[model samples]
Target: MEGEHSHKPADIKARLAAGPKASYLRDWVYGGIDGTVTTFAVVAGAIGAEFSTQVLLVLGAANLFADGFSMAAANYTATRAEREDYRRLLEQERRHIRFFPDGERQEIRQIFQNKGFQGEELETLVSLITERKDVWIDTMLAEEYGRSNTQSDPVRSAGATFAAFGLCGALPLAPFVLSIPEAPSAATGLTALVFFAIGSVRSRFSTRSWLRCGLETFAIGLTAAGVAFLAGDLLTRLF
Candidate 1:
């Protein structure tokens, strides 16, 4: 029984460590979608307003840089804060164990009991977990607080978020470069086609059926573009 329990933590640790790469990818992709959607809407609105190409370019560039950096900074700060909070909680748990061993032990038993453990089995499990200081801290973190000791580098996450967002945001503005003197309609059509394709590709990451996800994303992009267009038209009328 002890051996069986001993093996479980290792399995849990392994499971926890695995798949973070894919998780990171999904985060990056989703963040990119957010950035892209907003920028696309802004650019579309500007185009609909019949703003000078120069003004549109400036707005798009500003949106890309500002939104990307802002998102990255926000992510960095949030992740760092969460890590600090986790550390504080862990230290508090350690102090409780040190100063009130009996109380803490009883709390651990209660935690296990809440999970439906009872009798000698619960006692054995609590004893096993609380015997080691690290394990004890981990158990409290998991059971009492629902926290994990997983370390995520805020700087890395922020950088990835920025890069993903910037790359995606740049896609919608690509048409502006070609809008030169000869063909604005062609440029707009091309931009719409490209954005739709991107929406479809992004949909593959979600759990929804590909067709459904693709359509939803496509509609969202179109709706954003249409709103911007209408807003631009209204502004043109008003001012």
Candidate 2:
């Protein structure tokens, strides 16, 4: 009776471990917020200075491409360097595990002991973990050195950032791009929408609700724009 209902294939019955979640939320949010903020800052600045729509388009487009690409490239390099550092540290941990295993065993015992294991249970767990070299290595990397097994994808991260940067960052220029009348006012409204949208996307990764995050992002963006706009007005008036 226990075996009679078993119909699943062997591979189907066993679930494999999936790849770790990519650590790109920071890059995504940063790129998204920064891209849009900088582009909008330029637009607001141009508007304050009473520049023609042609001047707004020229400045906004230049800041959009130049700044967005630069941020994406920087994220890629920084993320790649982080992965390389992790790899190097992992190799060092492996060597330590190999050459000084007794020391590592003591360290493992201490780690679990700190977790409240004692007597037979502590010894048993240490034995079970060290039985597999990979598990042992992972334990040392996590327990002793405070690291995780996830490998970051720099190219993927960079692409996400760049895509966000390009899509949302260029929003402020949309009115001018389309040659809409009263372009500055329309662009401000559009900028608010863009801020809320990016913030909603950001909520998926963080614990914050979409509404709170959206409002907060919107506020920060508008504040930045106001400052930029004010600075432009001051400079224009002074000159």
Report the C-alpha lDDT of model 1 over 1-239, residue by residue, as the tens digit: 42232358888788666734323554475567666766776776776677887898899889889988898899889889988999999999989999999999999999989999999999999999889999999889988889887757888888888987887777667766765454445545544554566556766565566667666766766676667667766877788
Estimate the overall C-alpha local distance difference test score of candidate 2: 0.83
Per-candidate Cα lDDT values, in order, are 0.75, 0.83
**Model 2 Cα lDDT, one tens digit per residue, 107-136:** 999999999999999999999999898999
Best by TM-score: 2
Off by over 4 Å in 2: 1-15, 231-239
Please report how far candidate 1 places residue 22 from its true position, in Å: 9.3
